[model samples]
Target: MQAFSKVLRLVELLLIVFSVWSCTQERDADVGQADKRTVVSLHLGIKTQMSSGCSSCELVNKYQWNFLYRIFSGKEDIEFVVYCSDENKREVEQNLLYDVLILVDKSPETDELVVCHGRKTMFQKAGVLDMFSMRQITELLMDSALENEQPLRK
Candidate 1:
Protein backbone atom coordinates (compact mmCIF):
# COMPACT_ATOMS: atom_id res chain seq x y z
CA MET A 1 0.00 0.00 0.00
CA GLN A 2 2.87 2.43 0.86
CA ALA A 3 4.59 1.83 -2.48
CA PHE A 4 1.33 2.40 -4.33
CA SER A 5 0.76 5.72 -2.54
CA LYS A 6 4.29 6.96 -3.46
CA VAL A 7 3.70 6.20 -7.13
CA LEU A 8 0.37 8.00 -7.07
CA ARG A 9 1.95 11.10 -5.47
CA LEU A 10 4.68 11.15 -8.13
CA VAL A 11 2.06 10.91 -10.87
CA GLU A 12 0.11 13.80 -9.36
CA LEU A 13 3.25 15.98 -9.26
CA LEU A 14 4.04 15.15 -12.85
CA LEU A 15 0.52 16.01 -13.94
CA ILE A 16 0.73 19.40 -12.22
CA VAL A 17 4.04 20.21 -13.92
CA PHE A 18 2.74 19.17 -17.31
CA SER A 19 -0.37 21.32 -16.89
CA VAL A 20 1.72 24.39 -16.08
CA TRP A 21 4.00 23.78 -19.03
CA SER A 22 1.05 23.41 -21.37
CA CYS A 23 -0.45 26.71 -20.24
CA THR A 24 2.83 28.50 -20.77
CA GLN A 25 3.18 27.06 -24.24
CA GLU A 26 -0.29 28.25 -25.16
CA ARG A 27 0.44 31.75 -23.82
CA ASP A 28 3.67 31.99 -25.81
CA ALA A 29 1.90 30.85 -28.96
CA ASP A 30 -0.85 33.42 -28.49
CA VAL A 31 1.69 36.20 -27.95
CA GLY A 32 3.45 35.28 -31.15
CA GLN A 33 0.23 35.52 -33.19
CA ALA A 34 -0.99 38.81 -31.63
CA ASP A 35 -0.62 41.96 -33.69
CA LYS A 36 2.20 44.28 -32.60
CA ARG A 37 1.53 47.94 -31.93
CA THR A 38 3.38 50.94 -30.51
CA VAL A 39 3.64 50.54 -26.74
CA VAL A 40 2.88 53.49 -24.44
CA SER A 41 4.29 52.66 -21.04
CA LEU A 42 2.91 54.53 -18.04
CA HIS A 43 5.30 54.48 -15.09
CA LEU A 44 3.24 55.29 -12.00
CA GLY A 45 4.15 55.68 -8.36
CA ILE A 46 2.14 56.44 -5.21
CA LYS A 47 2.95 58.84 -2.40
CA THR A 48 1.30 58.88 1.01
CA GLN A 49 1.33 61.33 3.88
CA MET A 50 0.53 60.74 7.53
CA SER A 51 -1.47 63.06 9.70
CA SER A 52 -0.44 63.91 13.24
CA GLY A 53 -3.77 64.65 14.95
CA CYS A 54 -6.57 62.94 13.09
CA SER A 55 -9.70 61.18 14.33
CA SER A 56 -9.65 59.00 11.22
CA CYS A 57 -7.81 58.91 7.95
CA GLU A 58 -9.35 57.86 4.68
CA LEU A 59 -7.67 57.41 1.30
CA VAL A 60 -9.49 57.03 -1.99
CA ASN A 61 -7.10 55.75 -4.64
CA LYS A 62 -9.18 53.09 -6.24
CA TYR A 63 -8.18 53.04 -9.89
CA GLN A 64 -9.08 49.98 -11.94
CA TRP A 65 -6.68 48.53 -14.52
CA ASN A 66 -9.26 46.41 -16.35
CA PHE A 67 -11.15 49.52 -17.49
CA LEU A 68 -7.96 51.01 -18.89
CA TYR A 69 -7.07 47.74 -20.57
CA ARG A 70 -10.49 47.50 -22.19
CA ILE A 71 -10.14 51.00 -23.62
CA PHE A 72 -6.85 50.30 -25.40
CA SER A 73 -7.06 46.60 -26.21
CA GLY A 74 -9.27 47.17 -29.26
CA LYS A 75 -7.08 49.93 -30.72
CA GLU A 76 -4.74 48.49 -33.33
CA ASP A 77 -2.45 51.51 -33.36
CA ILE A 78 -1.71 51.76 -29.64
CA GLU A 79 -0.81 49.54 -26.73
CA PHE A 80 -0.46 50.55 -23.06
CA VAL A 81 1.72 49.40 -20.20
CA VAL A 82 0.78 50.53 -16.69
CA TYR A 83 3.69 49.91 -14.34
CA CYS A 84 3.14 50.63 -10.67
CA SER A 85 5.82 50.84 -8.00
CA ASP A 86 6.00 51.33 -4.27
CA GLU A 87 6.19 54.83 -2.83
CA ASN A 88 9.85 55.75 -2.52
CA LYS A 89 11.44 59.19 -2.52
CA ARG A 90 14.45 58.00 -4.48
CA GLU A 91 12.23 56.66 -7.28
CA VAL A 92 11.08 60.21 -7.99
CA GLU A 93 14.68 61.40 -8.54
CA GLN A 94 15.96 58.49 -10.59
CA ASN A 95 15.67 58.94 -14.36
CA LEU A 96 13.31 56.28 -15.62
CA LEU A 97 12.56 55.36 -19.22
CA TYR A 98 8.87 55.46 -20.11
CA ASP A 99 6.45 56.86 -22.68
CA VAL A 100 4.80 58.61 -19.73
CA LEU A 101 5.94 58.87 -16.10
CA ILE A 102 3.02 59.79 -13.83
CA LEU A 103 3.45 60.50 -10.14
CA VAL A 104 0.30 60.02 -8.05
CA ASP A 105 0.78 61.85 -4.80
CA LYS A 106 -1.65 62.03 -1.90
CA SER A 107 -1.14 64.45 0.92
CA PRO A 108 -3.13 64.95 4.14
CA GLU A 109 -6.06 66.19 2.07
CA THR A 110 -5.31 66.44 -1.65
CA ASP A 111 -3.94 64.63 -4.69
CA GLU A 112 -1.38 65.79 -7.23
CA LEU A 113 -0.20 64.85 -10.70
CA VAL A 114 3.28 65.03 -12.20
CA VAL A 115 3.52 64.19 -15.90
CA CYS A 116 6.65 63.66 -17.99
CA HIS A 117 7.40 63.92 -21.68
CA GLY A 118 8.46 60.77 -23.51
CA ARG A 119 11.15 62.25 -25.76
CA LYS A 120 12.53 64.98 -23.51
CA THR A 121 11.82 63.12 -20.29
CA MET A 122 10.98 66.43 -18.63
CA PHE A 123 8.40 66.34 -15.82
CA GLN A 124 5.82 68.99 -15.01
CA LYS A 125 2.93 69.35 -12.62
CA ALA A 126 -0.34 68.72 -14.48
CA GLY A 127 -3.26 70.52 -12.83
CA VAL A 128 -5.79 69.03 -15.18
CA LEU A 129 -7.79 66.60 -13.00
CA ASP A 130 -8.03 65.28 -9.46
CA MET A 131 -7.10 61.88 -10.89
CA PHE A 132 -6.11 60.50 -14.27
CA SER A 133 -9.03 60.15 -16.67
CA MET A 134 -9.24 57.99 -19.81
CA ARG A 135 -9.67 61.07 -21.96
CA GLN A 136 -6.43 62.55 -20.62
CA ILE A 137 -4.60 59.30 -21.23
CA THR A 138 -5.84 59.06 -24.83
CA GLU A 139 -4.91 62.68 -25.46
CA LEU A 140 -1.45 62.09 -24.08
CA LEU A 141 -1.03 59.03 -26.29
CA MET A 142 -2.17 61.00 -29.34
CA ASP A 143 0.29 63.74 -28.46
CA SER A 144 3.06 61.19 -28.07
CA ALA A 145 2.31 59.72 -31.51
CA LEU A 146 2.28 63.16 -33.07
CA GLU A 147 5.60 64.00 -31.46
CA ASN A 148 7.08 60.83 -32.96
CA GLU A 149 5.37 61.52 -36.33
CA GLN A 150 3.55 58.17 -36.31
CA PRO A 151 0.21 57.87 -38.07
CA LEU A 152 -2.68 56.28 -36.21
CA ARG A 153 -4.34 53.30 -37.91
CA LYS A 154 -8.08 53.84 -38.23
Candidate 2:
Protein backbone atom coordinates (compact mmCIF):
# COMPACT_ATOMS: atom_id res chain seq x y z
CA MET A 1 0.00 0.00 0.00
CA GLN A 2 0.99 3.63 -0.43
CA ALA A 3 2.45 4.95 2.80
CA PHE A 4 2.68 8.66 3.32
CA SER A 5 5.15 9.77 5.94
CA LYS A 6 3.79 12.39 8.26
CA VAL A 7 6.00 15.43 7.99
CA LEU A 8 6.11 18.58 10.09
CA ARG A 9 8.15 21.39 8.70
CA LEU A 10 9.47 23.29 11.69
CA VAL A 11 12.26 25.42 10.27
CA GLU A 12 15.19 23.82 12.09
CA LEU A 13 13.92 20.25 11.89
CA LEU A 14 12.98 20.83 8.26
CA LEU A 15 16.58 21.57 7.48
CA ILE A 16 17.63 18.24 8.91
CA VAL A 17 15.21 16.24 6.78
CA PHE A 18 16.05 18.11 3.62
CA SER A 19 19.74 17.51 4.17
CA VAL A 20 19.17 13.80 4.76
CA TRP A 21 16.97 13.19 1.71
CA SER A 22 19.24 15.12 -0.59
CA CYS A 23 22.42 13.38 0.53
CA THR A 24 21.23 9.80 0.12
CA GLN A 25 22.67 7.57 -2.62
CA GLU A 26 20.80 6.91 -5.88
CA ARG A 27 19.43 3.40 -6.66
CA ASP A 28 21.31 0.73 -8.53
CA ALA A 29 19.97 -0.67 -11.85
CA ASP A 30 18.24 -3.85 -10.70
CA VAL A 31 16.68 -5.00 -13.99
CA GLY A 32 19.35 -4.81 -16.64
CA GLN A 33 22.74 -5.88 -17.97
CA ALA A 34 25.92 -5.52 -15.86
CA ASP A 35 28.43 -4.29 -18.46
CA LYS A 36 27.05 -1.06 -19.89
CA ARG A 37 28.90 1.13 -17.37
CA THR A 38 27.14 2.55 -14.33
CA VAL A 39 25.53 5.22 -12.23
CA VAL A 40 23.15 4.83 -9.26
CA SER A 41 19.59 5.88 -8.44
CA LEU A 42 17.53 5.14 -5.36
CA HIS A 43 13.82 4.59 -4.82
CA LEU A 44 12.91 7.98 -3.40
CA GLY A 45 9.19 7.92 -2.51
CA ILE A 46 5.63 8.25 -3.73
CA LYS A 47 4.26 11.31 -5.47
CA THR A 48 0.66 12.49 -5.17
CA GLN A 49 -0.81 13.99 -8.33
CA MET A 50 -4.10 15.29 -9.63
CA SER A 51 -5.63 13.13 -12.33
CA SER A 52 -5.92 16.30 -14.29
CA GLY A 53 -3.25 18.95 -14.39
CA CYS A 54 -2.92 22.56 -15.47
CA SER A 55 -1.38 20.91 -18.49
CA SER A 56 -3.24 18.02 -20.09
CA CYS A 57 -1.87 14.60 -19.07
CA GLU A 58 -2.81 13.35 -22.56
CA LEU A 59 -0.58 15.83 -24.37
CA VAL A 60 2.20 15.06 -21.95
CA ASN A 61 1.81 11.32 -22.29
CA LYS A 62 1.90 11.58 -26.07
CA TYR A 63 5.04 13.65 -25.97
CA GLN A 64 6.66 10.88 -23.98
CA TRP A 65 5.18 7.90 -25.83
CA ASN A 66 6.26 9.42 -29.14
CA PHE A 67 9.87 9.23 -28.07
CA LEU A 68 9.59 5.54 -27.25
CA TYR A 69 7.82 4.92 -30.55
CA ARG A 70 10.74 6.48 -32.35
CA ILE A 71 13.27 4.44 -30.39
CA PHE A 72 11.52 1.13 -30.89
CA SER A 73 9.87 1.64 -34.26
CA GLY A 74 12.71 3.40 -36.00
CA LYS A 75 15.11 1.24 -34.03
CA GLU A 76 17.15 4.15 -32.82
CA ASP A 77 19.82 3.29 -30.30
CA ILE A 78 19.08 5.63 -27.45
CA GLU A 79 19.26 5.57 -23.66
CA PHE A 80 17.01 7.59 -21.42
CA VAL A 81 14.86 7.39 -18.30
CA VAL A 82 11.12 6.79 -18.23
CA TYR A 83 9.11 7.68 -15.11
CA CYS A 84 6.64 4.84 -14.75
CA SER A 85 3.73 4.54 -12.35
CA ASP A 86 1.25 1.83 -11.54
CA GLU A 87 -1.68 1.19 -9.22
CA ASN A 88 0.42 -1.51 -7.62
CA LYS A 89 2.08 0.72 -5.10
CA ARG A 90 3.08 -2.11 -2.82
CA GLU A 91 4.76 -4.08 -5.58
CA VAL A 92 6.65 -1.04 -6.78
CA GLU A 93 7.93 -0.07 -3.35
CA GLN A 94 9.01 -3.65 -2.85
CA ASN A 95 10.91 -3.48 -6.20
CA LEU A 96 8.72 -6.05 -7.94
CA LEU A 97 7.24 -3.75 -10.51
CA TYR A 98 7.41 -3.60 -14.28
CA ASP A 99 4.75 -1.17 -15.24
CA VAL A 100 3.92 1.38 -17.89
CA LEU A 101 5.68 4.73 -17.61
CA ILE A 102 4.88 8.43 -17.80
CA LEU A 103 8.07 10.22 -18.83
CA VAL A 104 11.30 9.70 -20.82
CA ASP A 105 14.66 11.42 -20.45
CA LYS A 106 17.89 12.01 -22.30
CA SER A 107 20.52 13.11 -19.89
CA PRO A 108 23.70 12.29 -17.89
CA GLU A 109 24.06 8.87 -19.57
CA THR A 110 23.28 9.33 -23.26
CA ASP A 111 27.03 9.44 -23.64
CA GLU A 112 27.63 6.11 -21.88
CA LEU A 113 24.96 4.01 -23.64
CA VAL A 114 26.30 3.34 -27.10
CA VAL A 115 24.65 0.05 -28.08
CA CYS A 116 21.16 1.29 -28.65
CA HIS A 117 18.64 -1.59 -28.34
CA GLY A 118 21.15 -4.35 -28.95
CA ARG A 119 21.71 -5.86 -25.50
CA LYS A 120 18.16 -5.24 -24.49
CA THR A 121 16.74 -6.81 -27.61
CA MET A 122 18.92 -9.86 -27.15
CA PHE A 123 17.53 -10.40 -23.68
CA GLN A 124 13.99 -10.38 -24.95
CA LYS A 125 14.83 -12.64 -27.86
CA ALA A 126 16.28 -15.17 -25.45
CA GLY A 127 12.98 -15.23 -23.59
CA VAL A 128 14.57 -14.57 -20.22
CA LEU A 129 11.10 -14.08 -18.78
CA ASP A 130 11.31 -10.89 -16.79
CA MET A 131 10.31 -7.32 -17.50
CA PHE A 132 10.68 -6.65 -21.17
CA SER A 133 12.96 -3.91 -22.47
CA MET A 134 15.96 -3.61 -20.19
CA ARG A 135 16.61 -0.33 -21.94
CA GLN A 136 13.27 0.95 -20.77
CA ILE A 137 13.75 -0.66 -17.37
CA THR A 138 17.06 1.11 -16.84
CA GLU A 139 15.26 4.25 -17.86
CA LEU A 140 13.01 3.78 -14.83
CA LEU A 141 16.07 3.54 -12.64
CA MET A 142 17.16 6.84 -14.08
CA ASP A 143 13.87 8.27 -12.84
CA SER A 144 14.70 7.06 -9.36
CA ALA A 145 18.13 8.60 -9.80
CA LEU A 146 16.57 11.89 -10.74
CA GLU A 147 14.83 12.30 -7.37
CA ASN A 148 18.01 11.95 -5.37
CA GLU A 149 19.91 14.11 -7.82
CA GLN A 150 17.47 16.99 -7.53
CA PRO A 151 16.07 19.16 -4.76
CA LEU A 152 12.96 17.74 -3.10
CA ARG A 153 10.97 20.86 -2.39
CA LYS A 154 9.83 23.87 -4.31
Candidate 3:
Protein backbone atom coordinates (compact mmCIF):
# COMPACT_ATOMS: atom_id res chain seq x y z
CA MET A 1 0.00 0.00 0.00
CA GLN A 2 2.80 2.41 0.88
CA ALA A 3 4.61 1.70 -2.39
CA PHE A 4 1.45 2.11 -4.33
CA SER A 5 0.77 5.45 -2.65
CA LYS A 6 4.26 6.63 -3.46
CA VAL A 7 3.88 5.68 -7.11
CA LEU A 8 0.55 7.50 -7.23
CA ARG A 9 2.15 10.59 -5.74
CA LEU A 10 4.92 10.48 -8.32
CA VAL A 11 2.37 10.15 -11.07
CA GLU A 12 0.46 13.12 -9.74
CA LEU A 13 3.62 15.20 -9.63
CA LEU A 14 4.47 14.21 -13.15
CA LEU A 15 1.02 15.13 -14.34
CA ILE A 16 1.27 18.52 -12.68
CA VAL A 17 4.64 19.16 -14.28
CA PHE A 18 3.40 18.05 -17.67
CA SER A 19 0.36 20.29 -17.41
CA VAL A 20 2.46 23.30 -16.48
CA TRP A 21 4.90 22.63 -19.28
CA SER A 22 2.13 22.30 -21.83
CA CYS A 23 0.52 25.53 -20.72
CA THR A 24 3.79 27.40 -20.96
CA GLN A 25 4.38 26.00 -24.43
CA GLU A 26 0.94 27.12 -25.53
CA ARG A 27 1.49 30.56 -24.08
CA ASP A 28 4.79 30.96 -25.84
CA ALA A 29 3.31 29.75 -29.10
CA ASP A 30 0.42 32.16 -28.77
CA VAL A 31 2.68 35.17 -28.32
CA GLY A 32 3.46 37.37 -31.32
CA GLN A 33 0.26 36.73 -33.20
CA ALA A 34 -1.84 39.41 -34.95
CA ASP A 35 -4.39 41.64 -33.20
CA LYS A 36 -6.22 44.98 -33.22
CA ARG A 37 -5.38 47.13 -30.23
CA THR A 38 -4.28 50.49 -28.93
CA VAL A 39 -3.15 52.06 -25.70
CA VAL A 40 -6.04 54.25 -24.62
CA SER A 41 -3.99 56.40 -22.18
CA LEU A 42 -2.26 56.35 -18.82
CA HIS A 43 -3.30 59.01 -16.35
CA LEU A 44 -0.27 58.65 -14.12
CA GLY A 45 -0.64 59.83 -10.55
CA ILE A 46 3.09 60.64 -10.54
CA LYS A 47 5.55 60.62 -13.40
CA THR A 48 8.05 57.76 -13.36
CA GLN A 49 11.51 58.85 -12.29
CA MET A 50 15.20 57.91 -12.69
CA SER A 51 15.22 55.55 -9.70
CA SER A 52 13.01 53.19 -11.66
CA GLY A 53 14.02 51.83 -15.06
CA CYS A 54 11.34 53.99 -16.61
CA SER A 55 12.82 56.46 -19.08
CA SER A 56 10.94 59.51 -20.38
CA CYS A 57 9.76 57.33 -23.26
CA GLU A 58 8.59 54.60 -20.88
CA LEU A 59 5.83 56.70 -19.36
CA VAL A 60 3.84 56.54 -22.56
CA ASN A 61 5.14 53.13 -23.55
CA LYS A 62 3.60 51.52 -20.52
CA TYR A 63 0.21 52.84 -21.44
CA GLN A 64 0.50 51.58 -24.98
CA TRP A 65 1.15 47.99 -23.96
CA ASN A 66 -1.70 48.08 -21.49
CA PHE A 67 -4.16 49.16 -24.15
CA LEU A 68 -3.22 46.18 -26.25
CA TYR A 69 -3.63 43.76 -23.36
CA ARG A 70 -7.02 45.16 -22.50
CA ILE A 71 -8.28 44.79 -26.03
CA PHE A 72 -6.52 41.62 -27.14
CA SER A 73 -6.07 39.72 -23.86
CA GLY A 74 -3.45 37.44 -25.37
CA LYS A 75 0.15 37.13 -26.42
CA GLU A 76 -0.47 38.48 -29.92
CA ASP A 77 1.39 41.11 -31.90
CA ILE A 78 -0.47 44.40 -32.13
CA GLU A 79 -0.04 48.12 -32.56
CA PHE A 80 -1.87 49.82 -29.74
CA VAL A 81 -2.94 53.45 -29.33
CA VAL A 82 -2.29 55.16 -25.98
CA TYR A 83 -3.91 58.05 -24.17
CA CYS A 84 -1.92 59.80 -21.44
CA SER A 85 -2.76 62.62 -19.07
CA ASP A 86 -2.69 63.66 -15.45
CA GLU A 87 -5.53 63.16 -13.08
CA ASN A 88 -6.04 65.14 -9.87
CA LYS A 89 -2.86 64.40 -7.88
CA ARG A 90 -4.39 65.93 -4.84
CA GLU A 91 -7.07 63.27 -4.92
CA VAL A 92 -4.64 60.41 -5.56
CA GLU A 93 -2.48 61.47 -2.64
CA GLN A 94 -5.47 61.79 -0.37
CA ASN A 95 -5.94 58.07 -0.84
CA LEU A 96 -2.24 57.42 -0.05
CA LEU A 97 -1.28 55.23 -3.02
CA TYR A 98 1.78 55.58 -5.24
CA ASP A 99 4.58 53.87 -7.24
CA VAL A 100 4.25 50.31 -8.48
CA LEU A 101 7.24 48.01 -7.88
CA ILE A 102 7.62 46.14 -11.14
CA LEU A 103 11.01 44.69 -10.30
CA VAL A 104 11.77 43.02 -7.04
CA ASP A 105 15.42 43.95 -7.36
CA LYS A 106 16.15 47.62 -8.06
CA SER A 107 17.69 47.13 -11.49
CA PRO A 108 17.71 49.41 -14.53
CA GLU A 109 16.05 46.83 -16.79
CA THR A 110 13.07 46.76 -14.46
CA ASP A 111 12.29 50.33 -15.45
CA GLU A 112 10.86 49.24 -18.78
CA LEU A 113 7.29 47.98 -19.07
CA VAL A 114 6.51 44.47 -17.78
CA VAL A 115 3.38 42.67 -18.93
CA CYS A 116 1.70 39.73 -17.22
CA HIS A 117 -1.48 37.71 -17.54
CA GLY A 118 -4.19 36.85 -14.94
CA ARG A 119 -5.03 40.45 -14.15
CA LYS A 120 -8.30 41.89 -15.33
CA THR A 121 -7.46 45.60 -15.40
CA MET A 122 -4.88 48.39 -15.46
CA PHE A 123 -4.83 51.91 -14.00
CA GLN A 124 -4.86 53.86 -17.26
CA LYS A 125 -8.18 52.38 -18.28
CA ALA A 126 -9.97 54.01 -15.39
CA GLY A 127 -10.43 57.63 -16.24
CA VAL A 128 -10.95 59.61 -13.07
CA LEU A 129 -12.67 56.55 -11.59
CA ASP A 130 -10.64 56.79 -8.36
CA MET A 131 -10.66 53.01 -8.27
CA PHE A 132 -6.84 52.56 -8.29
CA SER A 133 -3.60 54.49 -8.49
CA MET A 134 -2.02 55.55 -11.77
CA ARG A 135 1.25 54.02 -10.61
CA GLN A 136 -0.42 50.61 -10.63
CA ILE A 137 -1.78 51.21 -14.11
CA THR A 138 1.67 52.15 -15.32
CA GLU A 139 3.11 49.05 -13.68
CA LEU A 140 0.67 46.77 -15.43
CA LEU A 141 1.40 48.30 -18.79
CA MET A 142 5.15 48.13 -18.23
CA ASP A 143 5.43 44.70 -16.63
CA SER A 144 8.01 42.66 -18.59
CA ALA A 145 5.85 39.60 -18.12
CA LEU A 146 3.25 41.20 -20.33
CA GLU A 147 3.82 40.75 -24.08
CA ASN A 148 4.14 43.52 -26.65
CA GLU A 149 2.80 43.53 -30.21
CA GLN A 150 4.67 46.28 -32.06
CA PRO A 151 8.37 46.99 -32.13
CA LEU A 152 8.90 50.15 -30.13
CA ARG A 153 9.79 53.03 -32.38
CA LYS A 154 13.18 54.66 -32.08
Candidate 4:
Protein backbone atom coordinates (compact mmCIF):
# COMPACT_ATOMS: atom_id res chain seq x y z
CA MET A 1 0.00 0.00 0.00
CA GLN A 2 2.85 2.44 0.88
CA ALA A 3 4.65 1.63 -2.43
CA PHE A 4 1.47 2.39 -4.36
CA SER A 5 1.13 5.78 -2.60
CA LYS A 6 4.75 6.62 -3.47
CA VAL A 7 4.15 5.74 -7.13
CA LEU A 8 1.05 7.91 -7.18
CA ARG A 9 2.97 10.83 -5.67
CA LEU A 10 5.65 10.43 -8.35
CA VAL A 11 3.04 10.50 -11.10
CA GLU A 12 1.49 13.65 -9.65
CA LEU A 13 4.91 15.29 -9.56
CA LEU A 14 5.52 14.32 -13.17
CA LEU A 15 2.21 15.80 -14.18
CA ILE A 16 3.04 19.06 -12.43
CA VAL A 17 6.38 19.25 -14.21
CA PHE A 18 4.71 18.62 -17.57
CA SER A 19 2.17 21.33 -16.89
CA VAL A 20 4.93 23.83 -16.13
CA TRP A 21 6.88 22.86 -19.24
CA SER A 22 3.77 23.17 -21.43
CA CYS A 23 3.07 26.65 -20.11
CA THR A 24 6.65 27.67 -20.79
CA GLN A 25 6.44 26.37 -24.35
CA GLU A 26 3.28 28.31 -24.99
CA ARG A 27 4.86 31.51 -23.66
CA ASP A 28 7.88 31.01 -25.87
CA ALA A 29 5.70 30.55 -28.92
CA ASP A 30 3.84 33.76 -28.18
CA VAL A 31 7.16 35.58 -27.93
CA GLY A 32 8.64 34.04 -31.06
CA GLN A 33 5.80 34.85 -33.38
CA ALA A 34 4.77 38.42 -34.01
CA ASP A 35 1.04 38.96 -33.55
CA LYS A 36 0.84 42.12 -35.63
CA ARG A 37 2.34 43.04 -38.99
CA THR A 38 2.21 46.29 -40.93
CA VAL A 39 0.78 46.20 -44.43
CA VAL A 40 1.68 49.07 -46.79
CA SER A 41 0.23 49.67 -50.25
CA LEU A 42 1.68 52.10 -52.75
CA HIS A 43 -0.35 53.65 -55.50
CA LEU A 44 2.18 54.91 -58.04
CA GLY A 45 -0.51 56.45 -60.26
CA ILE A 46 1.58 55.69 -63.33
CA LYS A 47 -1.19 56.40 -65.82
CA THR A 48 -2.15 59.86 -64.62
CA GLN A 49 0.40 62.36 -65.96
CA MET A 50 -1.19 65.76 -66.33
CA SER A 51 2.09 67.71 -66.61
CA SER A 52 0.91 69.89 -63.70
CA GLY A 53 4.43 70.11 -62.26
CA CYS A 54 3.94 67.11 -59.98
CA SER A 55 7.35 66.43 -58.58
CA SER A 56 6.30 62.91 -57.79
CA CYS A 57 5.67 62.28 -61.48
CA GLU A 58 9.08 63.63 -62.34
CA LEU A 59 10.68 61.45 -59.67
CA VAL A 60 8.77 58.42 -60.94
CA ASN A 61 10.00 59.13 -64.43
CA LYS A 62 13.55 59.67 -63.23
CA TYR A 63 13.95 56.59 -61.02
CA GLN A 64 11.15 54.42 -62.47
CA TRP A 65 9.37 51.41 -60.94
CA ASN A 66 12.59 49.42 -60.80
CA PHE A 67 13.85 51.73 -58.09
CA LEU A 68 10.90 50.87 -55.84
CA TYR A 69 11.07 47.21 -56.74
CA ARG A 70 14.68 47.03 -55.62
CA ILE A 71 13.79 48.49 -52.22
CA PHE A 72 10.64 46.59 -51.21
CA SER A 73 10.48 43.36 -53.20
CA GLY A 74 12.60 41.29 -50.83
CA LYS A 75 10.70 42.24 -47.70
CA GLU A 76 8.46 39.45 -46.46
CA ASP A 77 6.60 41.50 -43.88
CA ILE A 78 5.38 44.34 -46.08
CA GLU A 79 2.70 43.96 -48.75
CA PHE A 80 3.11 46.53 -51.51
CA VAL A 81 0.82 46.97 -54.51
CA VAL A 82 0.83 49.48 -57.36
CA TYR A 83 -2.02 50.63 -59.57
CA CYS A 84 -2.18 52.94 -62.58
CA SER A 85 -4.80 55.62 -63.07
CA ASP A 86 -5.21 57.82 -66.10
CA GLU A 87 -7.41 60.44 -64.36
CA ASN A 88 -9.07 58.94 -61.33
CA LYS A 89 -7.54 58.80 -57.84
CA ARG A 90 -10.52 56.92 -56.47
CA GLU A 91 -9.11 53.55 -57.42
CA VAL A 92 -6.29 53.81 -54.88
CA GLU A 93 -8.57 55.25 -52.22
CA GLN A 94 -11.01 52.37 -52.38
CA ASN A 95 -8.51 49.62 -51.60
CA LEU A 96 -9.14 47.82 -48.28
CA LEU A 97 -6.22 45.42 -48.18
CA TYR A 98 -3.54 47.68 -46.73
CA ASP A 99 -3.12 49.37 -43.38
CA VAL A 100 -1.50 52.38 -45.05
CA LEU A 101 -2.14 53.81 -48.51
CA ILE A 102 0.34 56.04 -50.31
CA LEU A 103 -1.11 58.01 -53.23
CA VAL A 104 1.18 59.67 -55.73
CA ASP A 105 -0.75 62.32 -57.61
CA LYS A 106 -0.71 65.88 -58.95
CA SER A 107 -3.82 67.07 -57.19
CA PRO A 108 -4.33 67.81 -53.45
CA GLU A 109 -0.73 69.05 -53.54
CA THR A 110 1.82 68.89 -56.32
CA ASP A 111 4.85 66.66 -55.81
CA GLU A 112 3.26 65.33 -52.59
CA LEU A 113 1.82 61.99 -51.56
CA VAL A 114 -1.33 61.48 -49.61
CA VAL A 115 -0.69 58.83 -46.94
CA CYS A 116 -3.65 57.38 -45.15
CA HIS A 117 -3.94 54.80 -42.37
CA GLY A 118 -7.37 53.27 -42.47
CA ARG A 119 -9.68 56.34 -42.75
CA LYS A 120 -7.22 58.77 -41.13
CA THR A 121 -4.77 60.86 -43.16
CA MET A 122 -1.24 60.50 -41.82
CA PHE A 123 0.90 62.43 -44.25
CA GLN A 124 0.05 64.99 -46.92
CA LYS A 125 3.64 65.11 -48.14
CA ALA A 126 5.81 62.10 -48.92
CA GLY A 127 8.03 60.81 -51.72
CA VAL A 128 11.05 62.13 -53.68
CA LEU A 129 9.77 65.62 -54.36
CA ASP A 130 9.48 66.35 -50.65
CA MET A 131 13.08 65.09 -50.12
CA PHE A 132 11.63 61.99 -48.52
CA SER A 133 14.09 59.26 -49.30
CA MET A 134 13.10 55.63 -49.68
CA ARG A 135 14.59 55.00 -46.24
CA GLN A 136 12.33 57.66 -44.74
CA ILE A 137 9.32 55.97 -46.26
CA THR A 138 10.38 52.70 -44.67
CA GLU A 139 10.69 54.41 -41.32
CA LEU A 140 7.20 55.85 -41.68
CA LEU A 141 5.80 52.43 -42.45
CA MET A 142 7.51 50.91 -39.42
CA ASP A 143 6.16 53.64 -37.20
CA SER A 144 2.70 53.16 -38.61
CA ALA A 145 2.97 49.44 -38.05
CA LEU A 146 4.01 49.90 -34.44
CA GLU A 147 1.15 52.30 -33.88
CA ASN A 148 -1.21 49.68 -35.23
CA GLU A 149 0.12 47.10 -32.80
CA GLN A 150 -1.18 49.03 -29.83
CA PRO A 151 -4.54 48.05 -28.38
CA LEU A 152 -7.30 50.63 -28.47
CA ARG A 153 -8.66 51.91 -25.17
CA LYS A 154 -12.35 52.32 -24.43
Provide TM-scores for the models. 0.29, 0.22, 0.25, 0.33
Tens digits of per-residue lDDT, candidate 1, 6-114, equal 8875664554344334423433444533223344434332233554243112122223233443444445445444334345323433433233333333221222222
Error of 1 at 124 (Å): 8.3
Per lDDT, the best of the predicted structures is 4
Cα-based lDDT for every prediction: 0.39, 0.29, 0.34, 0.40
Worst 10 contiguous positions by lDDT, candidate 3: 101-110
RMSD of 3: 16.7
| Residue 87 displacement (Å), model 3 | 48
What is the C-alpha lDDT profile of model 3 across 70-140, one tens digit per residue?
54433232222221223323332333222321111111211122222322122222223222454564354
lDDT of 2 by residue, 8-107 (tens): 2244244333423332222134334333322221121223264435333312223333333333322212233333234323333343222233322211
What are the root-mean-square deviations of the candidates from the true structure over C-alphas? 17.2, 16.2, 16.7, 23.7
**Candidate order, TM-score descending:** 4, 1, 3, 2
Regions more than 4 Å wrong, model 1 = 1-37, 49-65, 86-133, 139-154
Worst 10 residues of 2 by lDDT: 106-115
Error of 3 at 20 (Å): 0.9
Evaluated against the true structure, the overall lDDT of model 2 is 0.29
lDDT (10s digit) by residue, model 4, range 1-154: 9999688756645543443344334334444333333233333423335664643443342342334335544444434444334443453344223333334332222123333333333443333433455555556655654565542221
